[model samples]
Every structure is written in structure tokens, then in C-alpha cells.
Target: MTAQAYCPDPWTPTAGENARTSALVDRFVELEAQVARARAEQATLLVSLAEIAVEQGRRSGSESEYDFATRSIAAELGAAARIPEGTIRGRMADAVTLVTGFPATFAALQEGRISEPHTRVIVAAGERLDDDSRVEFEGIVVSRAEGVTVGQLRSFARAVAEKIDPVPLTVRQAEAMALRGAWVSPLEHGMAEHRMIGPAATIYAIHDRLTQAATKLKATARAAGEPDPRTLDHIRADVLADLTLTGTPTAGDGLDAIHATIQVTIPVDTITGIGDDAAFLTGYGPIDPDTARRLAGNAATWVRVWQHRDTGALLTVDSYTPTAAQRRFLTARDEHCRFPGCRQPARRCDTDHTIPHSHDGPTTVTNLAHLCQAHHRLKHHSPWRMRQGPDGEIEWTSPTGRTYAHKPTPMVRFDAEAEVLMPDLHLSDEPPPF
Candidate 1:
């Protein structure tokens, strides 16, 4: 009897195969950079065309004619590019800003150092900065754009621009607050995206409170070991519907007993009226210190957190209940989900053991982190691995052997003397009295 040898396809790549794949990836990235440069060239040309059109319109007649010329130029370009004229006009305005107001950022794009999104973020963040400040802002942001993701760059650009802006955030925020309103934009599948533009703190507080009530509903379901089909997001949406339509949340049990809570980190000096440093709002970037003070004064409980003078790493907090203290520390440490670029607020996340408790992972502050339910499952069910350093930097490794290090956003503190003060909040928590 003769038997044929079995030969199966290779599941793992050889060294040479891996090298080829790496080279291909590098080439793909290079091509993307080239596309970005081409986009910059196109934007420059569009700006030139718009300028010429406006000049011609000015020579011919009135302001209405000039605007019409701009619109006509957009329509012409839109027809060529197969984009809507309205979109083309918006692009034209952005192009003008990029070419004229942000020359260095434009050059960075032209040289293929950054992409279109990066440029947009830089421009928008620096928009409130004056000419000299904008130039400085562009130079700093463009220099840092190469090594970071677009999201990271956006946060950095915004913080930097805020620090350097000539206008006080309080003044700008006041002006913006006047324009606050709510609107709805229709979407497909009988859906819509409800939008609101208002004070950042108030908006964040509203969301935080909603998330808290939703989380309570989820916890109640889990405690009963009942199979609830609705996810946290679904529950949040339903709760919002109940509150707005019926004036009370009727979606879950014991929601009336749940209290809405929000976390705000403010500097000691700022709270004491000594400094105007912006406070770090959880899940959002920065808010004016005055707002932070007001929020702190209105809270029902206060947690005093200490930090090193040189490094702003969290040192300690006055502890009460061990479980509650741990949750507070983790929430303060991980402002959002530990997953890279996931800004899901900590209040909506599960406190997960970096190393599973069943696997002898101790129930300690260093051993725990906050992860959204989706990512918590992903960590367990998938090939992704996480490791936390002593400094609270989390390093996540994928199945492909690539690692991503996510550092905790440094807490804004002057020294170990600061306290986040929360007095009794008289507002009702049931329907979110925002």
C-alpha cells in the first residue's frame, strides 16, 4: 500500500515573508503621504481660483455679485470634482484658511509630514488665536504632528492653543454660550442625530448623569442574573426618551434611588482664586477654572487628591470605603476607556482587573483599570493583551505583536495641597435637573 504525503498551507509567515509584508505596509503609508501632498496642492489651486473669482466679481459690481461669483466658482469646481457645491464652498473656505492663515501648517501638508485631518484640527483649534499666536501655534502643532495619532494631535493642539490664546477662555466661553441651542439632523433607517451646542461643563454633566442612570439599570439587571438584550447605549437612549417624553426614567428598577455624579479635576490655586488654570473635565478636554470651582462647590462630596510637585501623577486620596475608594482612584486615573483612542467616559466603563482576579491578580489600585464593556470582552475573548506599568501607563499588545502604550493624561495639579470640594447638591438626580 502507498500513502501520499500530506502538505498543508503555511499558517505562519517566514522571515522573508514578514520582511516583504513590512515593506508593503511601508509603501502603503508612503502612498497615503503622497495623496495628502496632492490634496494640499489641490487646496492651494482652489484658493487661487477663489481669489481670482472674487476679484473679477469686485471689478464688475456689488457684494451680492461677489458672493455669487464665489458660489459659481464652487459650482464649477464641484462639477469637476463630483462633489456638492455646498461641500465645495466649505472646502474652499478651509483651503483659504490653510493657504493664507496657516502657511506653516499648509507647508507641512505639502511636504507630506501631516494629513488633511491633522491640518484641519490644527486650524480649527488655532482659529481663535490671533495672527502672531496662530503662527506660533501652527509651528508647535505641526512639529508634533508626525509621531502622534490624529486624535492625540487634536487634544494637544487644543490644549496648546488654549494656553497661548490671547483671549481669556471665560470671555470666549461667554460669547459662545449666547449661541447655545439644540437641533436635530435626520439620518437613515428612521434615525436622527440630536445635537446641542452649549457650555462644555453643562453638556458633559448632562451626559455623565445620563450614563450614571443607565449604568444603574444595567447593574440591576446583572444582579438579578436576568438576560437583558439592551446594551448600555440602548439603555441610555431609552432613558433619555423616557425622561424627555414622560418626565421620568421608567426604563429600569431603582433608578429613583440613583444619584447623578460627575468628576472634575481642578488645581488648588484655581480653586483658591489664585490662578486661572483650566480644569480637566473627565471625558472632555479642558474647562475654564471658574466653572470647575462652581461645579466643585455644588457637589455633595469632595475627594482630595495629592500629586508629586514635579510630576503630576496621582499620589493618594483620603480614603473611606476600600471598594468605593478604589473605584474613585481608578476613575480619576483612567478618565476614559484604556483602549487606544477610545474616549468612552470612565463612568460608563467596568472596573476590570488588568490581570484576572481568578488568576491571582490582586484587588489593588495598580491592578485595576476602567474599560468599556465592549473592550472588556475584547480583552478576554480576543488575542489582545494588556500590561500596566508602575506609573499607570498601560501597554496593549495585539496578536500581530504590535504594542501600543497609552499613558494616563497627567492630572492638572500644582502640588499636594489641592482639594476637589463637593458640598451638598440640592438638585434632583432622578430626571437629570440640567
Candidate 2:
């Protein structure tokens, strides 16, 4: 046991009766901190040992680190502790990280400035690099320490992962991985199938609903039956249970599309003007009433109807007062992200107000259009704005304040009586004369 193990925590504790309660609480916190430190050190030591083990393996005919850590830590802790070989190696792997991370991590822990998750992250980082590889990592962490606190180092590491053997963690990395993960691929595929076959649903939302519905089926099965019949395990259970569990997929044929959901932030005065039954139109063209407000009885994401002056056409929007329905409607009508050849689906695009709402841009069809998150950020972070004309054409102003005209959509109509083209196929239109 170390001296730090007896140190007190700074949190103002609960009300207690005994005089020793304060000291007890402090000691308990100290013990927990010490345990945390021990876990981290164990991990760090393991990392250094792994380096040693790897070197030894090269020298002694490909021996594993598992053998080395067991022999090493056991001698230090003693045989009576009867530590398992894997446990010691795991601990040493943990220790290897503390070689660099300990100073910053311990400092944060002692000061109670960081969450346990953060400390564990550094510990894990060290283990990944180990001893021989860690010096480079130490440099990276030190170089990254400032922004690394925000976990951006992981993001940065992940962005250029091919250069590093063990890729770092980051939001972008997670998203890419999510798209590639086996389960997510099927989920996205299912959503795509639904989009093409059933309705124009937000792919992400459809996956979520399917996952939820699947989970509910699983829970229901578990509650009612034993031996989850679906399993091929030794213990025989209800086979019907497993079949019943994957509910959402079975019900998918009957599923309806949940169109666009936009988050609206606006002033109260603007909402009063849009009368009740203010339904926001989803991107795929379904409208939802003020149910959020009706359910909570507090104002939220109120919908608005924007009537075009010349066209007499109405588009819905979501704002603190304005709705994004018009934004959704415009994006789908345009096809793809309006950014030249972006190819990102219409549903994923962010409906950006060409004139920022802060500048009093109305949530009308012409004022709203979709851009993917990257371009939406570009529009804000860069000096850019988008303008829509009555012809439904969008003009984009670049960061340099230079404007580019986006070409109009090509018109096509089926001519049933026209001569067909293609050797074995036809597009149901007349071919242009050669």
C-alpha cells in the first residue's frame, strides 16, 4: 500500500452521523484512486514487459510475451499471490502505457480532473504501442497533449490510419468503421432495400427502428420462454422463440417511412404567427403535426407552412419557429446533394438556410436547400452562401465570394411510340438521330 492510498477526495460528501464518517469517506476515495493507479500501472508495466518479451522472443526462437510477463511479475508479487500468467501480461501491457501516459494521467487522477474512462484510454494507448514502439507514441502524445485532452489526437491518428499499424480512435473513424462493420452493412442494406422497395426513409432512422423492433422481439421472447428456442445450444429451448425474436425484419414489409426530422431553433414570437395544426412536411413528403408540443405541452420544433408568392405552393419547415420541411422538399426535388456531383443521398443532406436565419431568412422553399454535413460546415466555416431561383436552380457563392451557376436538371419524358435504342435494351424514349 502507498501513502497516496490514504489521501482524501475533495468532493463534499453526504450527510453522516459519525465523527469518523468524513475520514472514512476520504479513505474510501483514496483507496479507489489507489486501485485505479494500480490498474493503470499494471497495464503500463505490461506494455514494457511486452516490449521485453518481444525482444526475448526474437533472441530465443519466437517465444510469446505471455510466458515472459508471468515469470517476471510473479517473482515481484510473490508465489503466494498465485497470479495468473495472462493477468500479469495484461497488467504489464497496461504498465507499458504509463511509461508515457502515467505523468499526465496520474496528475489528472490525483487532481480529480479527469474521468476514469480518460485514464483507461491513455493506458490502452500505451499498451497498443508497447515499449519498443512507445517512444514514438510518447512523442505523438506529448505533441498532441494540448488538443489530445479533448480526444482529438485519437481522431487525428485515425484519419491517417494506414501509416500507423494500430489505428487511433476518432468520431470520423467510428463512422467509417460503422459503415464497414458487418452488422451495420446489413442494417444499411436493409434500409436501402426499404428505400427502393417500400418508402423514402432516412436510412439511419430505419436502421434504428429495425434495431429497436428486433430488440423488443428478443426481450419479449426471453420473458416468455426458456432455452431461447432459436439457439443450437446443448440445452434445448423453444425454436419458435428465436423466429419470433427478430420482429422488425418480419414486419418490415408493412413499415412506413419516417421522413425528415429537423431540429428547429427560433424565437417564440415567430411561432405564434403559424397557427395550430402546424405540421412539418418530412423530406419524402409526409407531414407531422405539433405532436412534440402536444405531448410535452412545451413549445418545441414547431412546424410552419411557407406559401410561395408567385407559385402559390406551400412548403413546411422546422425552426425554433420555422420548419425544415421546405428544406427537405427542396433537397429531394433537386436529387443528390446540390453540390456538383456530390452523389450523397438526398436524405443525408443538411437543409441549409441560404440566408442564415440569424439574418431573418424565411424558412421558405427558395431559402432552404440541402447540403451534406461537410458542405453545410463549409458553407458556415467558409465564406459561402447558396441562392435558389424561381426556376429551382441553385447558385453557390464560394469562399472567395465568387459565384458559380449550378446547371438546371435535365428534363426527360417517356415517348411510348418512339423507336427504342440499345442492342438488347430500351430507355422508353426516341433516340437522337446520328
Q: lDDT by residue for model 2 over 1-434, one digit each (tens)?
A: 10011111223323442336546766876776676566555554556656765666567663565465446654555444577655665555555545444565555544444444555654554545445455454444433333223343332232222123343223223344445422222355444211222222233334434443444445466776742443322111222223237532342322323222322212123233343222212222211223323322343333332335556334545552333344423533443456654544445455555565556665565555557667665555544556776545677754333455553222111111111110111111111221
Give candidate 2's error at residue 40 in angstroms.
4.8
Candidate 1 segments exceeding 4 Å error: 1-35, 111-113, 143-153, 184-194, 218-226, 309-333, 348-392, 410-414, 417-434
Model 1 over residues 258-306: C-alpha lDDT tens digits?
6565667777787878988777665456688788888878776777765
Q: What are the C-alpha RMSDs, in order, of all predicted structures?
A: 9.0, 22.2
Instruction: Write down the lDDT of every candidate, Cα atoms only.
Output: 0.72, 0.41
- Which 10-residue window of candidate 1 scores lowest in summed lDDT? 425-434
Error of 2 at 78 (Å): 9.0
Q: Would you give me the overall lDDT of model 2?
A: 0.41
Candidate 1, pairs of clashing residues: none
lDDT for model 1? 0.72
TM-score of each: 0.76, 0.31
